[model samples]
Target chain A: MNRQVLLFYPLLGMILLGLFIGGLAYGAVPIPLDHVVDILLGKGSDKIAWQNIVLQSRLPQAITALLAGASLATSGLLLQTLFRNPLAGPSILGISDGANLGVAAIMLYFGGTLGQFADWPISGYMAVILAAFAGACAILGLIIYFSAKVKNNVMLLIIGIMIGYLASSVISILNYYSSTDRVHAFVMWGLGNFSGVSLEQLPFLGSCTLAGLLLAILLIKPLNALLLGEMYAANLGIHIKRTRILILLCTGILTATTTAFCGPISFIGLAVPHIARLMLGSSNHKMLVPVTVLTGSCIALLCNMLMVVPGSNMILPLNAVTPMLGAPVIIYVIVNRKNIQYFN
Target chain B: MAMKQTSVIKTSDLSIGYTLKGGRKKCVHDALNLSLYPGEVTCLLGLNGAGKSTLLRTLCGFQPPLGGKIELMGKPLSSYSQGSFSRMVGVVLTEKTNAGGITVYELASLGRHPYTGFFGQLRQEDHRIIEESLIAAGIAHKAHNYVSELSDGERQKAMIAKALAQQCPIILLDEPTAFLDVTSRIETMVLLHKLAVEQQKAILLSTHDLDLAIQLGDCLWLQEKGRPMACGTPEDLILGGAFETFFSKEGIVFDPGTGKLHTEAPTVPVGVEGDLTTSYWVGNALIRNGFKPSLVSEEYVSVCCNAPNDLRILFPVGDMRIAESIAEMVSIIVHKS
Candidate 1:
């Protein structure tokens, strides 16, 4: 690593640490910073209720926000590089739409309920997660199959967009057929929240997102090679087809895990990579990927904190809060594309 | 004969074409024998749709030849694995790269992919090779600049550096000069020539710039549809009249003396009397203005090139016009006629 990156990480590390702690201490209930630290250390809190809220609720929510943000951001970076298109993201590939389709099937078609099948009662949360995973895997499988058949990356990207449209069409149909109550539930889920994962669910969210992040780290070389474009990458002895499949696998895992837990959170996957690129002034991926991961975590924790700035009683939907931060970056990128050194 | 300068790449009775899904084939060229020698620049010149790119793709093993065989270093092309093939041949294609945000140094370092570890970490030697490539390609000054910030010529040089860093024995380029301006085009050709001699690497490129090819190419391959391909030294090919009938068309003529193509135009005979250099340019302007040079007196318009920039045209109608330059003389003579 170069000196700039070495310095960049610690600075970002400090910022991320600050955001993580800030998310824990500041909420609607107005818990003191000292009390939060004491509760974390298992020293009895003056108010036991505040302790439970901070430990069981705010801590898990903050970790979920951090992991999900990093996953989405890395996924965005991977997809953007793989397609050689600046606008590509996890949602652009229709993987998130696939996750939406899964949730729609559970909430809209199943009428907000899960039943026993084969004398086994499927829990609601596991069913939704499984459905989302299945949906994402299905889209990922289609992309991989098409990638093998189509030698052109641009064509594969087009096919992915078309597939995403198809999934959205199916989701629209499910929403149309559902009752008002189920539709409301589906809509609420669609608005997106980082609080869905409880204390018990943090391990699942953390492991899956970490695994996806690790896979992205492993792909740093191929990703950098791909920035040269596919033909040149292949000339460098990279198996273009294998690399494409691997990229889709990584993006699919990250998007699916985050969308499954957080209800198709928007903009983070599409915008964070651009932010990281602007900050680093490079597309090298070796340093870019790790920095993107950290920046994603910091942004997510900040957004999570903002969601409750109006107080716990008036929580902001994450989907609403993210676009405010993410959309402006995208607009700036589009407006000053020629001035961007990396944009061609 | 110094062992005839061992061939880097050779094709024997090769047939290349496009094969469709049902095994149907559309043959572009057939029965071809070609060889590339080390320390030489070979240019493949052809008209559009004449299969220059197809031949290049086949030679670099990007696509398979329909029939016959290709050998690299005396081994069948198919026998070499991907890793060894990359180590042997570097390719520079004409596709506009989207390698924005990547510094020139980083882009060149990618040529070390085949030699580096799984993560592509650049060792001390890798960095040295990359720096040397940058210097050789003459873009070392812009090593830290983003590729998108470089001009077309600089970007092309950067790509050339990347290929140099690959350290392959042979480099194949597909219309490397197609997008460059005249100066950059000649500079690129010169660079390739220097690289071929200094590195002793075999360099092959397909181009439509016949003038530059004839001037700079050590050897040439001329291809045209429905005609047998021609291959030889540029002088030999021109002397053998290979260029005269190449892509034969009604208004275009190949001048073997100058090794350039000229539009076939009607010329009126004119007598030229002056200093050799001045007369030569006046003759050129006359030809372009549809006049032919002749020594005849009657029925001929005489011209006097008094100095480098002075010209006097005496028309057949017994009219005289003095002009300062060839353009003014040609205009006066043309408008008067």
Candidate 2:
């Protein structure tokens, strides 16, 4: 890399360290910086509540932010390449909305019954995760099936938006009939949070994200070929059908896992790839993929830090913080539309 | 160059067209048989919508023939894998690329994918071929420039260079001069001819520029709707009335006198004599001055020179520049005969 990327690494390192410290220091119950470091090193005082807050609660939240950021950003990059559209992303494909619809149906219509059966066979969290996973896979399968039929990228984008609207309408009908308590629970989940995913579930969630990211990396060659166009990619001997299916599957897994744990976080998946391209000034996936991953992690960590600002009693929602960072980039792309070269 | 080689492409009983689901077929051409020899430029000529592009596509294995067999070299066209088939035959399509920020060299290097490994690593031979192909197409100086910055003619050359870098034995181009100006059209035709002759490759190109095609091609594959014809030379097609039958519509005629097409009547004095060769040039001069040239049995030089005062001047090679009177015209004609 270049000297700028080299400098960015150390700067990102320091920012990551600061965010970790801030995550431990500024939760609902504030811990001193020295005590936070002590708790991290396993040398804290005899305050059991501080240990619980620092070790169990804050650390997993911070790691989840980092992983979710990187996973969603990489997912955005791969989708953009596969579809050859600058505006394509995980949420735009209806994968995230599919997961949201799954969660809404479960929480609004089947919330009380699922909790009643929590001790019998499956837990409520497991049921929600399974429902989200199935919903995500269903939409991904549909997108892949249609990708073979639709040769134009812009048409596929319009189809994806239509799917999202269809899923949203279904969720609205479910919300209208549900009881007040269940609706309240669904509404709380819709607010979006990184604190819901416990440390015990992090390994499974993290590995699934990693697996999807690895598949995306394996597809870099075909992605580069696809940057020109599908016909050009086909001329280069890439099996276009199989490659598009793989991209859908990977984007589905990443989007579903993040939406299962945290509610639908918008704009990161749609905006981060463009940010990475602007920063790197290259469309080559070999460099773009890693840069998007890191930039995503940094942005997510920054958002997490801003959520629990210093000397604040009320915590900001994660979704509320993302638009502030993502909307400007979208506007910048629109304003400089004449200058931005997308596919190639 | 290789000589007396086997046919590079062979089509037997080819009935190619689009087949609908209900057993109805809109056949472009039916029951055709032809062989393309190596080191020859075969030009396919036709009026609009005469299935010239369809034939090229069918031969390249992009579209399947309704009832026929196509063999490249010795093996069947369908028997080869897509990768191997692409390696054997390069194609320059008429489709325009809308991609931006792609460099000319980067676009040309995509042709090396067949020889490159799975990850598309460019080998030394691949680099050499790319450089040589760029030089051959006269776009080596534009390797670093973006494709979007190049003019239409330069971009057309770059596209041809990309196909050349594929190093295929057979090349097919569809309407290569469709949007080019006159000079660019001639230059591209000359480049294709050089590739066919110097590289010893089989080249087939479809074009509506019949004048350039007839001048440059070694063989002509003439198609008129369902009727297909082939001739060895341009003169053969002209003599066989293929050009007249296909292109001569109302108000247009192919004149054999000048070997150039014309849209008006010929007007020259009937039976004017002074070595028929020199009289041909005199007739051309009359036609240039808005007077038609017509062949007649009479032996008289009538010049109604309308430039000044309707002053009629008669000229004979025997030294008679008689002027201004019917008596002088008769005297000049008597001396010339």
Candidate 3:
């Protein structure tokens, strides 16, 4: 690795650490950094409320941002490479929207009636996560099935868009028929959040994201080969069909898990890879994959900290802050795309 | 005898094309027998839509043949796994590579995918091979430069280096010279010819540059649409009339005497005689002027060899015109005739 590629990991790691500390320290309730560190170390924080805030609430939320950021960024990179489209993101295939549709079905149609859903296996928040996973994987499975039939990546992308459309249509119908309070509940979920995963839910979310990221790492070889296009990649002995399905599966699991807990977090997946590409000056995924993971966590942590409004008790929605960082980066990338070696 | 004993790739009664819906086979050509010997360059020449790409893709194992068998190193093409096949046959495609961000070294390293492990960590031996391949392809100077930073010809040389790095015994390319300028085209052809001889590898390339192909190819495969491909040495094919028949179209015919192609048969016949250099150019002008030039013709045109300036053109009308150049001579012949 050159100087730029070698320096990226540590630089992004430090930035991520600072933002993570900021996320833990500066919430709606102001907790000092030292106390936050003390609480994290299991030392008494001088107040019970601060302890509850630090140990139970902010820690999981910060970790959620970290994991979700990495997962989404990894998915975005995979989709962009798989489809060979620079603008492709986690939500492009409607997998996250599928998760949104699932949440809509739960909040809008079922109204989260624990008694009504008690006949089923899971309940409450668990039901929502399960439903979101089901919905996302359902669309993913559909795409994989069609991927076997459709030889063209652009065609498969169109098929993904159509499936996303179908999922959205169902969500709209569910939203339309619901009561006013239920629609508000569904809309609130649609606004997106990172603090949604509780202390108990972190392990499940963490493992799924870990599995997906590990699979993505294992995929580094084929992904690098794909940079030469499909036919040439096939000539290099990379099995294109198996590799495509594995990529979809990996992107699906990561997107689905994050969307299940985090509510279709936008831009991080689509833009972080480009950000990593810009910083590293290379697209060889060996270093790129790790750099993207670190940069993603940093961006997510930064965005998580920004979601906290200063001085006032008001908190900005996570979605509202991501595009502020993500959109401009994407625009800059688009305008100068020809000059960027990644696009070439 | 050594070439027959050491054929790298041999196809027996091969048929290639697409298989349409409902198991319908849209065969482009069938009953083809071909062999590529080590240390030789075989250039496949054909018209547009002659399925050159299809045949190449089939040979590269990117697609299956509609019928027949391809044997690489005496083993069935189907018997070798993808990894083994890759280690045996290196391929350079017609499309431009999208590996712009990676360095030329990285791009060449991709050719070692079959040999590298899952992470594609290049071993010491692999690195040595890649460097040697780069040097062999004449791209060692730009080894550290980005692929996007290279010129078109350099980029093509880099891609060829990538295929070379595969360390395969047989290298196949489809339209390798299609995107290159005349100089780069000749350079790439010469490089392939050198690789075939120096590396002792069997190299087959499809190209539209017939003049270059004829000059460089050790063997030529002429594929016409829906017809069995013709394969032979360029001299043998030209002598046996395969070249003439394959390229036979309106207003053009293959000239066996010059072993090149020329335009339509002329209306008038004229005799021309001079030194080889002057006579050839003088005859070229006659052919373009719709007049046939031969030594045995009723109407005569002759070049005076001893004239250094103000070259003399003898017309059949018994008038001698002094011309400075072939261009001026042709203009005078048009005006006088």
Candidate 4:
């Protein structure tokens, strides 16, 4: 690693830490910065409301944002590397849309109840989570099957988009048939937010994201080899089919779990990897992967913080705030794509 | 050509082509016998759709063969695992791939992937080998440059350097020089030839540049649609009348005497005499202008070294004409004849 790359890690660390702290301090009820830190350190604030706000509400949201950011960004990076396409992300394969479809089926059709289908009763959140996982995996399996049959990357990508479109149309149909209140609830979920996953739900989301991220880290060598294209990567002893399957599987797990809990947060996966690539100016995957992880966390936290207004409590929808932050970066990257180095 | 030394790779009765999904076989060629020797460059030449690329891909284990056997260094080609197979063969392709923003050193280091550990961190010894490979490929000066920043020729050299870093005994290239400029094409061929001779690495390449292949290839594999491949030394193929039959087309012939391809078949024979060097060019002008020039024929077009700029054209009807330049000479011959 060069001096610049080495220096970038610490800078990213500082930014992530700063944004995380800001996420805790700035909320609907604005708590002082020091009190938020003290409350986090277990020294309770004088106001129990402040204590509950910091330790209970803001803490889970911040951690969820950080983990989701890393997972989504890593997925995006793997897909980008695998397909050699700049635009690939966790949602590109329609895994997130599949999750959305599952949630739609449960929330809209069954009134968010699994009790009618099975003997064992399940909560609304668990039902959504399980259904989303099942939906995402179903689509992931379909994509993997096509991936095995289709030799070309661009063709596989087109097939994935076709599958995504299929899932999305189903979601739209479900939404149209549901009651007004159920439809409103479904639309709220679709709007997306970082605070949806509770303190209790963090364990499942956290472990899965960490495992996916670990698998991604282990995949650095193969991912680097893949940057040269399939022929050379095969010549370099990489099993192209196996590597591709693993990448899709990892991206599926991350996108499904995050979309299930936190809803379908957009563009972090699509934009953060490029942000790291733009900063690092290299795509070796060794540095790009870890840097992508950190950069992802920082940006997600930054976006989460941007949701809360400083003087007042007019919090914006995550979907609205996300596109505002991410679209310009994407446009800049696109317009100046020639100046940026990606695939050789 | 030397049979005593063991062959680097040999195939017997090998058939190559694609097998469709419904068990329908699309056989390109069958009953093929070919051998590649260490310290030699073997060039495969064929018209489009003749399965030259398929053959190259098959030999390197990229495509499965339709029938028969291939032995690599006395071992069955299929027996080696991907890891072991990669150690023995290096492949370079002409197709443009994802040119990622990686430095030349990092790109070259990827050649060590088969040997590297899980994380693929390079050791000091691997670094030394990478440096040597860069030097050998003649891109050592641009070792730090991004792969996307390099020109096509430089990028090709970078890829060759990575293959060199593999330390593989055999290198298979599919039209390695197909996309290069003339100078770079010759440079790449010469570089491969040098590697073959100096490193004793068996090199096999398929190319469309017949002139370079004829000059530099130690052995040539000639393929035509649905026909068995013809393999031999370039000299033997030329002398045994294979070149004439293999590449025969209308208004085109391979001249064995001049060792060049010509696109003209002149009718009336005209003999050439005097300055030997200038006479060669005079003959070229005559053939192109619909007159066959001969060194020892009844009719003659005389060129004198004393007056090198002067050319005298003798017509069959006892008419003689002297022209100042080749263009003027061609004009006079075109109008009168």
Best-fitting candidate, scored by lDDT: 1
What is the per-residue lDDT of model 1 for residues A1-344, given as tens digits with 9 covering 90 to 100?
36876899999999998888888888888888888889988896999899899988899889999999999999999988876778878777777888888878876887652222112233656677678877887887786677669857667778888999999899889989888878777787788888767766777778889999999999999888888877788778888888887887788778887887788888898899999999988899999999999999999999998887564478888989999999999999989999998787
Which ranges of candidate 4 are over 4 A from the true structure? A113-127, A141-159, B2-4, B274-277, B296-324
In model 2 chain A, the worst 10-residue window by lDDT is A113-122
**lDDT (C-alpha, whole model) for all candidates:** 0.85, 0.76, 0.84, 0.83
Candidate 4, residue B123: how far the Cα is off, in Å: 1.0
True contacts kept of each: 0.66, 0.23, 0.72, 0.64
Name the DockQ score for candidate 2.
Answer: 0.26
Error of 1 at B284 (Å): 2.8
What tens digits encode model 4's per-residue C-alpha lDDT throughout B1-337?
Answer: 3454688899999999998999999888888888888899999998888889889889878889999999999988999999999999999987556655889999999999989999999999999999999999999999988898987788888999999999999999989887789999999999999999988999999999998999999999999886668888899999988887777767678777565677865667666776777777877777777777665443544333224477777766566777787777778767765
Q: What lDDT would candidate 3 get against the real structure? A: 0.84
Off by over 4 Å in 1: A106-127, A140-162, A176-182, A309-312, B1-3, B265-280, B292-324, B328-337
How many steric overlaps does candidate 1 have? 2
Show where candidate 2 strays beyond 4 Å: A1-54, A112-130, A140-155, A308-311, B1-4, B19-26, B96-99, B179-187, B229-235, B249-337
Comparing 1 and 2 on lDDT, the stronger one: 1
Q: What is model 1's DockQ versus the real complex?
A: 0.65
Inter-residue clash pairs, candidate 4: A343-B99, A343-B100, A344-B98, A344-B99, A344-B100
Candidate 4 docking band: medium
List the pairs of residues colliding in candidate 1: A342-B101, B268-B292
Residue lDDT tens for model 3, B1-337: 3336568889998999898989999988888798999899999999888888888989999889988889989989999998898899989887655688999999999999999998999999999999998999999999998888887888889888999999899999989898789999999999999999998989999999999998999999999986678988898999999988998888678877666677766767666665667767777777878877766433666656333345677766677778878788778767766
Q: Which stretches of candidate 3 lie over 4 Å from their true place?
A: A1-3, A113-127, A141-162, B1-3, B296-298, B305-310
Could you arrange the candidates by TM-score from highest to lowest?
Answer: 3, 4, 1, 2
Indicate whether candidate 2 or candidate 4 has the larger TM-score.
Answer: 4
| Best-first order by DockQ | 3, 4, 1, 2
